[model samples]
Target: MFPENKKQLKLIYFNMKKIVAYILLVFIIPIASKAQNVSPLYKDSIQLQWVNEKYDSMTLEEKVGQLFIVAAYSNRDASHENDILKLIEQENIGGLIFMQDQAVHQIDLTNKYQTASKIPLLIGMDAEWGLAMRLKDVERFPWNMTLGALKNDELVYEVGKQIGVQANRMGVQFNFSPSVDVNVNPNNPIIGNRSFGSNPDRVAAKGIAYMNGMKAQNVLSSAKHFPGHGNTDQDSHKTLPLVPDNKADLEKYHVAPFKKMIDAGVQSIMVAHLNIPALEPDPKIPSTLSKRIITDYLKGELQFKGIIITDALNMDGVAKMYPPGDVDYRAFVAGNDILLFSQNVKVGKQKIIDAINKGEISEERLEESVKKILMAKYITGLNDLKFLDSKNIFEDLNSDVNKALTTTIFEKSSTIVKNDNKVLPIKKLKQKIAFVPLEQTDYDQFLTHLQKYTNVELVNVKNPSEINLLKDYDAIIVGAFLSNESVYKPYKLSDNSKAIINVLPQDKKTIFSLFTSPYGLKDLDLAKFDAVTVHYQNTKEAQVAAAQTIFGAIGVDATLPVEINANLKEGKGIATKHIKRLGFSAPENVGLGKKNF
Candidate 1:
């Protein structure tokens, strides 16, 4: 391996098929049938041209190397030596994507890794929200669900720009982010907060805003899990999830944000390991390996001319869904431009080589993708960027801009659901208050915050039979912040929770303030409680929002996105507007939905 800095390679990078076309056109130049043309590399390098003069100057191996992206580590020690050097030298891989685990070492690792390679690497990460999401030793902003309540699209965009800043500081070129999934299913385990919200148009607006923010900082944004991974009941990481929906549903909900971002000039699209029956029939074949969807819908119809990358092939979604014959080869055939994180590169390389030898995957397709890969490198100014600038990276990595950006988002999202009798702003509660802390040890901070507002009565119902412990106060407010969603869905009214409410004097006034999802309201007897307010998130902002709304200090009208009842009708508390609204208003009072933990 040539371990010199910014290593240069003597290899070709061009679309062999396009080159052949030009050649045949050249041979027919008896009457001068062609314009003076340039190479793809030359075209891409200067002024971001597609048909330039330098493609003709590169070698065959350079083009092949550009099509592959190898998984690499940034460790300075020899721990990263073998795989990093082998791929960079033998494979001439075009780029690297850092995992949270891969970036634990210092930033100096970039110089060593880049020097070992023959080409300047374009680095990327799955830093959806920020660097803190994946990498350890970094701060995490609020998750996406809390963010959805915030109405400030600009804040969301700023988050992207800040993520780009940190990533770029660490030598990353792309941020695989702004997960455009519209989270309609609350039971969706993987993509809940990862999504912007439950509305497609809202997600689209946020996606465009975030993309613009990323573009402001020159980071290529990728809209991922194409089609949409929000409504499915299964986790792709475990098995291929088949999202059965008609074209109308897809266009209306799932494809809305993708179309918006593609129009906004997103640089790449990362395919997910999902099985949409309407798009392709292969029960086991994910969209990452589906030609019908990737080529027909994404390329032809959408007209996206940039690169297409698959999510890590090592993910169980691809591993369990694919067979042993190097599914990446199938992915290439299906129109993916980069084979990201293939579990075994040797196997992947051999399979692709065998396919080329057998002529099953034409060399023309390979060359086309290689040209795209090179074009990305050339246009990103990878050759111009100083990837190893370590002078003040530690101080600049997580700049103050990120903390402010996160704070902005949290501020806008806090919302207030309902205030039946204008008891919020603490004037009403504090005047004649009895804070019945939902007596649970696991949530000390939640109760500790509850204590700041009112006097507490740790109401513990010894048994259902012992119920009069809650009778003395003029008004009762229950503080139940530690409840989880699963604990409420099948809906069990906590015997103790109901017991406390049960013992309250028949003439005394009482209310239930659910701090998690309003679904907890279903667990309690809603009819029995005099006034009920549901604040979906329990963040301090949510609490404050709920508090303000309860007293008319903030207007309380945020519509609940999920069902909060088994009462009125068969499908009672389900919000009908959420199913089809482009963007729905949350049960907002103050900006409670905006804060993140």
Candidate 2:
């Protein structure tokens, strides 16, 4: 074996090594690759078996029915219930998204509908903040804008988990929440407070955290209103809103959060009724019905592999574009798995069947969405159909733990955006303080909380002439509480209120507490106030927190989540000293555990 010549020896050695390398490649690489792929498949084998079996068992009509998730109102009368029963019996609808009603009523209705259906129906809700978002007699969490103000995103996660827990207890399989839309446009009528904030990164981070928390509770989460509804001023419920950004701008801003959510394995996404010319060329066609937008951009480009749900079909946004049956058919063709809130489920079902018969909608396409729906049902454990326990549901939803968390959210979310002359902490008791109410409704709690610290005079400035009466007080505390019925309502101050604020003596210390949207301050001159605080909502907890912050009972550390104007930007907060009587406690003491739910 010893070579006589060096060149011949080297060539022989190289040939021998090449032969060994080929042997290893032929044998080892395939086995390694097979193992890597097989491992994931093994992990998913049970789910795959269940999905395949259930999908195979489904009749064509049943499979078609699975694609429709109609709207149910717990607050409706007997006629509505009978109508729903008819749809369930005739159309065999697969799911229902519960709308406004009492929690108890919803539970009863859900059980009734489930009994009527041949297959177990998946129940969902728009419980973004909590069950109280749609139903009465249920606990309400802080709005998304309020949650956005917190520095600790962990709290946001806990909020989501808690909401999910309530949703699960109420038998909601899916919670269409964590609206990942980045609210860059402050004037956005529909999505201002519903969205996390103006920053895409922050919105994405918060949305992922929330979705994960909900997922932990076995309640599927949906990142909503894609590609984005945050830039539109028109409410989609009434009309179609246009997202005027090009694809590049959308990817950077509007689509950023959605991309993050999809990458994080979000279970579902709600397609909005928006017109984006860059993505869909057809004029006046909604993104909900645009194949280019849904199939091409979201599914193809983004590679999203989950249930794609359309926003409520009853909304004028898509309803105006097509007739009743056509709307559902177009949305189905556009790649949406669930046709939500169809105006006429019977008609919609027939239309879809007709389309499928005509080869417009392929059997493969129908099976794809139907399989996803069945898979979701399996994932939610609906295959094992268990009725919700109606007893003590309200007590479970509105627990002491939830109340403590609500208080914590308000305390952390209330921001002291402007504090000139250091007028907070109300240290000098010698100065007589007058509490002026500039609210549509009575804000007795705010005044009552202030009165606990010192004897404060109440002045109702309904007219301009009442402004002069405030001059006697050494310091005037203006409490502006706005109605929190809907986000669409005008949050700005009235002209009379503005005039009253202007006539107030600038030299005198005037503390302005705004228990409304931060945008309400945009109309007023910030220089006129000695101190300015934003409560961000008119909730009683917020009122109490603002009052406590004023009297130095609680420290103010929350930063503005969104910009009000040029003078105030996001994250603008002024921390003030607490009085000697003030105290603090850990979140754990209030039952918000560090461990996951």
Candidate 3:
């Protein structure tokens, strides 16, 4: 049961059914599993002795099936439900990870699947920041980039707590998130903004704090892209990334945060699709398939007893390296417990079946991985909290309290780095001012709120020349927003936007409002702009907060937790504005929070 966004969910269901059918025909070698005379609900730790004994009784076919965690869909048209049932009935596969779209109707689908298979599936998610981080029609919190700014680790825990609540309600047992990668490279297109921050200590602390909330909620969390994937410019989703660094570099900059996370009692670590010569010199193989790194380093050196899961098998990084079926075989040998997003479940099952028959992949190894996966299941309480009545998330998600915390973080963070304005508290609210929105839809709702305090003219500026409206107003307030989005990089006013802002009347006051991450300020050429106000998100709250700061309402204690440039030290966001409306009253709706509160 994917999102009622029926079109995409149905398509995913289609592929799932087809894949399940293939597994059924070849690998449905039914082997009856006698329930260990153990208690139905495992209260304490899953008795390792009983589990090992139970696993020993499983037939060869059942053991092999335990290694596969196939993707499935709910569309009855493809009818893969029976295929999954056959495996549970026969092979006893481990778990399933949902995609962005698979989140919809997840509860009912899981119920139906569990009823057919008679085995509880360890449901997983790429809830990197939260479940909504990837899914549509869901509430999306700010990226880790914004969280990195506030330096409030407790907030991360709150976020994790909320994530656990939402995900658990949807029957999710594991959350693959709190990317432990310390972002040292600004140019790192993929992990920069997703990381907590650049400092190893901070990244470690923030990651641990977030995990605190998750673990407290009993949500299984997996610290990911082992060794660290934050420095590479390559998107492994497209091509294999190389972490070409020496052991010292890895230990100092990259591995530090991960070590911190592992120490924090994390339940799992996801090996990246990286090729690092320091750990595994063979560029021919990815970390996901290299025993040298997976077993020798991750398992032997780090002593991570928890399950090791591979990133999505469909990713170009792994897909290009091995055929679909072989990826499963190699990943198992590499010590991974789960073969995520196994693109070819049918062929993959047979490969495992063959690997075991030929002794290429030992049955002992298969039992080890499967046992860990299942143990993880018992530990996560999935056996007890199976399927909750599905809630219509559209209304229940993103409550007002959550948005206020986001507002406090973002608004208090919009520091004024440089303002010659003594002109900022603009002396005259009676002055005509231009409201030039940076993006086509930049805080449109907040613009209406600006009318409450100011006697000003709001001008729509699509091109730089639109700054001509600057002639009519005494001061120019440029609501220029930027992000890590590919197109927005190397941000500049452009020919037309620049020409207009540059030619602004020198006699009049000018204030530049930067509503994206502050790192974007480097591209703005601070010399031309008289004042800079950075209200992190482009959310309506960001707009309202930024405008109020201009008029002096809220106290400004906001600062950057990370250094943006050589001149800007860590904790150096410019103190630009203060709150106008008084009191600590919460907003009616959090999703629209602003800096003005």
Candidate 4:
């Protein structure tokens, strides 16, 4: 027993140390977990300590800087990067909102920006549908209108979770998304496809699911254009669109979803730059600058305890009405905790500082917002900073899982509003069908997929008299490929094309396939067609899904997200049971033994 045994003694010492460490971990892990579980808005003990300590250490200039979130672009040159760096170092700006960038470039820039800041920066993106909205080559999820068509709210939740996961992958803290503007106005220049649907209750339900899903991944969601931008005829980016509804109608149609989102504990609300005389008596004052709208109503009446953010200060909606720093000061005084995309950060910060010195804004008021910003950063896990490793990031962002989810979303969201005489799921594969594209556009994918089930002829036509050429086919499938370049672009058919469409069903069994926003349905006469199917976008996935639905490879479960006309109201969809005749598969299923596929 007295012999020296170095190896055995060392092993015994290591085991004892491990046992002690395990005992410590047992107590420490739960405490950390519990702290993390606490809502940042609630300001638990640990969060309060960090928020207060950070607030106390900051100077007035730094406190003022914390309220401004300037825009950043990875796609820009070195001069832009240097400017952003200057803001972080000199001005001590609060955060960044990256726009229109490449995936790898954005990630690398995020790390560089985060490393340069004295305090952790809160990175956000306008990724309403996903990063594809602002970043190139990322997985593009379905638009909110597409998601609104789904009967299952859980699917929409999964979409939000996936978007959040991708945002987190790129080291982003916030996503300005789930535009809960119940799009009741078809003439709305923006917020068409961005909104879930026209139904306020449905919009609120989907928005709540999406918000919760993002929260599950620690990403903050901001419900936008509050008090609603749904009923405006003009784009807020261009002018201060007047929301003309009375207070009761505004509450019923436009503001209902925002109220519901507030009730559901959404982390942020972006005040719109709209002139609503009903909510705010002053017709000249936009909601973003009105204390009655933001402070008294949203914060006081509705009791929204979360951070209030203003829409971009550079937009003409508010920018044209005020000078450079004036708009930011007004939004701040009105109750917005964060001023987004300020035209001049230097001037804005100076203006805010001036207000504080003149006693127009109390130091206590400034401290409240600054502390709230710090708490948000802590909640996003910025207290313990970790830079993103760019290895396989592009591939990881557009993984197989993302593609599969997208395919399922498109398939489930293919809606058929009318099927006169039940002409859908064309059972006779041997019938002579002509694929007529209404516009002078590409329909190769649609035509090819249609031919997968049966032989179809292509009819190229320019005039209304071309309807005569389609008389040879047993049935006619008309495909309208509308441009999705911008929401402001015209989605209606030309006069000549419209004439052909109206006359085609009178003589032939015409099936209309629309691949664009549902708002365009107002221009069309739905009652004239024998069958109508809507695939919301012109992507290849939508094209293939539209073909599958026509041939009965998939059934129709999606309903109209927005009301088109009096006849085609919201929730108008004809659910089709899947027929056994056709199934979707690889070409190999019939490739080997094919006798003309």
lDDT of each: 0.63, 0.83, 0.69, 0.85
Better structure of 1 and 2 per TM-score: 2
Candidate 3 weakest lDDT stretch, 10 residues: 31-40
TM-score of each: 0.76, 0.88, 0.82, 0.90
User: Which prediction has the highest lDDT against the true structure?
Assistant: 4
Question: In candidate 4, where is summed lDDT lowest over 10 consecutive residues?
Answer: 586-595
Q: Write the per-residue lDDT of candidate 2 for residues 370-484, one digit (tens) a residue.
A: 8778778877878688887789988899876777788888887778877776878788776688888885666887887788788888877777777778778888998888888
Give the Cα error of residue 269 in candidate 2, in Å: 0.7
Model 2 segments beyond 4 Å from truth? Answer: 1-43, 583-597
Instruction: State each candidate's clash count.
Output: 32, 0, 18, 0
Report the lDDT tens digits of candidate 4 across residue range 416-456: 98898889988888778999897638677889899988998
Report residue 375 deviation for candidate 1 (angstroms).
Answer: 3.6
Q: Write the per-residue lDDT of candidate 3 for residues 1-597, one digit (tens) a residue.
A: 447687988888899999998876665422111122221112233445546665677776666666667666544433566666666566566666666454555566777666655346777887865767645666666667667666457777777787887776677788888788876665666776677777778778878877888877778888877889977878888999988779998989888887777766777888888888898888989988999888998878876667788888888988997899789878887788788878666677887788778878776787767677666667677446455675666544555555665666555555677668465545467778777766435566456655556766677766665555677677777776554342224433345555556666676677877766565665455666677766655666667767667777665655554566886655665553443453232453333345436
What is residue 348's positional error in candidate 4, in angstroms?
A: 1.6
Clashing residue pairs for model 4: none
Q: 1-597, model 1: which lDDT tens digit per residue?
A: 653443333222235567777876776442232221222122212433432333454455555566667666553357565677777778777777776453435356566667776667777777776776556556556555555555566777777778777777777777887788876665676776577667777777778887788777777778877889988878877777777778889878898889888877777888888888888887777888889999988888877667788877877777876653377777888899888876665566677777787888787887778766666666556656574566765456655555555544443454434334543434533545555655333444434444555565555545556555655667766666653322122223467767766665656566666666443565565544566665544555455544443344344333333333445211112111111212112323223343421
- The per-residue C-alpha lDDT of model 2 at residue 297 equals 89
**Candidate 2: how large is its RMSD?**
8.0
lDDT of 2 at 461: 76
TM-score for predicted model 1 compared with the true structure:
0.76
